[model samples]
Target: MTEYGPRPVDRRLPTEEARDLMTLVRELADREIRPTAAEEEDAGHFPRATFTLLSESGLLSLPYDEEFGGGGQPYEVYLQVLEELAAARLTIGLGVSVHTLACHALAGFGSKEQRTERLPDMLGGGLLGAYCLSEPSSGSDAASLTTRATRDGDTWTLEGTKAWTTHGGVADFYTVLARTGGSGAHGITAFLVPGDAEGLSAAAPERKMGMKGSPTAQLHFDAVRVPDSRRIGEEGQGFAIALSALDSGRLGIAACAVGVAQAALDEALAYTAERQQFGRPIADFQGLRFMLADMATQIEAGRALYLTAARLRDAGLPFSKEAAMAKLFCTDTAMRVTTDAVQLLGGYGYTLDFPAERYMREAKVLQIVEGTNQIQRMVIARHLAGPEKR
Candidate 1:
């Protein structure tokens, strides 16, 4: 219905079901998300209603088990769905990714009883979730987190501050990591904490440049007590669990980046073709044409990279290195393409009158989140060079 874009992407989905899912997502995006994205974002309003609709429509729980209210879709199909959602609005797409990340620890490592008891509500019960791992002093060096969980008889007392939490105050539950032993990665443990727990409070959301609708804030746990049943994985295994979740989460970020890049390129193509200049459209100029061609090519390449990583993940093979590469390349591509898009649109692009500037700003944070592009390089380097010599 929104006739202000280049053309729809021709996706090669694996199954008819996947194709239908794509169509449903596109329809929903066109009708609900794409229309209000700019207005709601400008107002700094979080679309909790839309999020509830997504939950009811089964869009929020695609990559998990069907028996537990998930869609049981493969990563290959799931990431593409994420891409489509992101092309409409990055806030929703990235929020879904973060929600998936918050669910990973329990889905992958929780005991059978825990899964049966809690996974259903989490997957499709309309409960939003947040992942808490990064702290004020520890981001790239996540193992150095100072948030600690002290043990008592049957409960663990959580006392620490978690920074940069994506859903911070709004989330219904939190997947938190804290130091439970000595210093370093081996001393950490994971816990599932309710958002309403007494003494657990969220700071005012950070004033971010873009993605204003998604709250990113620090969470404070002042002697919040969690039962032993909420512990995820072994006591000393939290770091490894966090890293494993990130490997998959990076793919989610990569898909979202590609979606944003594609959206920018579509806007650029549309603007160039219609807006006239001296004699004809500016798209007639060779210089600008080449830029559009390069942007499109980069988007395709980034999509292919993430899909390849998704396939590797679906096969249950080792894909951490490829995931890092895809995240790195796709996010960097988004940043470059979105910036170039703003340039191609000339003066109007810089103004909020067009979505170009918003796309550009949103693309910037993609490179910084999930893992900074610099940290991604370190990961790739370690995979190639086989860990640094101590």
Candidate 2:
């Protein structure tokens, strides 16, 4: 079979600087990420050093404000960078996305003092972060989360468990949500908690089928205390902050999905061109050719959809619906395309000897993370037809 390598995506970056950024990202992915991706992933090793390299290279803070140590790139450029990194290794790409999400509340809503004091380190000072919103009992109905934060003078003590945190044990900081007053979304508040706080601890990482290199775990806050200065936005505004961050985060997931789909398509194309059957390459057959064409088309469409949403976000227009649409379509496309890639590879695709099976396994989680595909549909419908009546 022909040797498989990442095909350089023809990106339509707006500025020369953005183009240069893409080049740097591609070089880094080739040099520091792609080479050991399979091995590290197979060994379930989190590439902390690789993340440090990304931080030093300024890839970790692409979409935030420059004054706060961000790269000041538009979401369009930032997301394309994510796609490239994800094509090389999903763990790195998704980790960056989660870190960005973790910084959202503070970056977007914190006071100037808070941003000046904390944003620089969180953004580019080599600090990894995690978002804490989901709990064991509340996943889809996040408004019903039971985590509580009680205020005593200038200190807030948090108590509860947050489930499915992406960088649970390894993060340097966490953006946490907790109920401050009564039950439901309006009573919730957001806080920025240091990872090494006395009462903060992580449970064992969840054993997952794929993306094993990235830890997903539950965090228990046992009277974890935070100064009032660490509170992000006003009390009872946490749910809104969380939802706002997720709207952008869904776009990140969409980009990662396209990356996975593109990688799978590339693999299938390489394998089909060299694998011969009945005295001709499988790629020469019309059926397989059609399959390849469909895969490529879906990937292109998904890319375009995400870019459209990103452009909308950059222009400061409403993009919640578009973000939902992109997340839904792109992740579903990844699932379908990766499955077809496995089919094209035949028996080899089913084994760990080839990356196709790994791609297939990895694609399955995209449909479930950030928000489930079912939730994406609900979000889309809420925009089109209004919220469902209770």
Candidate 3:
């Protein structure tokens, strides 16, 4: 019989340079992230040095402008690289995604002067960023958020709590969506809040199920003062900015899901082929072989879906619906794939000895965060029902 090899598809996708970078990134993740991820997660600590290396490699700014030290790659490519990174260390993958979301407002809508001023440092090595939009009472329904930002002539004094802030305490800066007028999406405004601002404090990190190295905390904006110049755009644009950022954020989460699924699949395949049962390896069994096939299929499908949406975004088309679809499908696949990976390995998979357990734990969060899968369905359904065919 003819020898079999990896399946052939449109493998020739990303540019040569991007492929080279991906190889380097995968090697870096294998060397640096995979080894330390578990320890950091167990200790509930962030990986500062890893992020510095990511920034230095020009990975963090892959989708940003080249003039500001960014690689300026397509979101399609940028997201896949993120998936590769996440497959090694989810916390780092998410940290990069959230930071990218935190910078979305300035990149997409800010003035040229603003872009030129902040892009370099923000894209520079070792810098971190956060996006603050959620509140204790408002999550999926963000318009009803209670954070108040009162105008004081040319300054704004913000007072309220922003919940579920990623990179909460450690971020160099934050993109804050706060109330500037009345309650509702229209009444809000966005600001770039520096970490050193007076009256701004982050609560102790919240205990999480997975991706523990990615810090999550509440931010208390108690009369935090900011110059009007720091505003991301016009007044009443916070909702718009937040929505735009989230549209991008959804893709980030989708990439993360793909990564989780890929990692789980990799472990399951390795374990199945190496671990012996009865007279031979588990890979010899047809039942388990089908499971491995399913895992690989799911990961491939998820990758294709997210990359399609990312391409739409890079092409400047309306991609909100696609983004939501990708987020919903990929995250759900992650949950299912990782769960199957655990099942394939039986007792051994249930323990911390295998990464399957951690991958399973990490998969759950992707379904809930970045506009829950429920919300994603609503978004998709709305677009489907709309008059325009997009």
lDDT of 2 by residue, 1-390 (tens): 222355545456999899899989988988888888888899999999988989999999999999999999999999999988888889998999999999999999999999999999998999999999999999989999999999999999999999999989999999999999888889999999999999999999999989999999999999999999999999999999999999999999999999888888888998999899999999999999999999999999999999999999999999999999999999999999999999999999998877878788888998988889999999999999999999
Cα lDDT tens digits for candidate 1, 1-390: 123354444455888888888889889989999998999899888888888889988888899989878898999999998998899999999999999999999999999888889888888899999999999999989999999999998899999999999989999999999999999999999999999999999999999999999999999999999999999999989999999999999999999999999889888988999889998999999999999999999998999999999999999999999999999999999999999999998998999899989999999999989889999999999989988898
- Point out where model 2 deviates above 4 Å: 1-11
Q: For candidate 1, which ten residues in a row score worst on lDDT?
A: 1-10
Flag clash pairs in model 3.
none
Q: What does candidate 3's lDDT look like per residue over 1-390, in tens digits?
A: 001112332263468777787778777887888876777787877898888998888878888888876788899888978887788878988888998998889888888898898878888756889999998889999999989989989999999999999899899999999999977789999999999899999999888988888889999998999999899899999898899889999999999998888888878888888889998999999999998888888888888889899989988999999999999999999999999999988998899878889999999999988999999998999898865466
Which parts of model 1 are misplaced by more than 4 Å?
A: 1-11
What do the candidate models score in CA lDDT, each in turn? 0.92, 0.92, 0.87
Candidate 2 TM-score to native: 0.98
- The better candidate by lDDT, 1 or 3, is 1
In Å, residue 208's CA in model 3 sits off its true spot by: 1.1
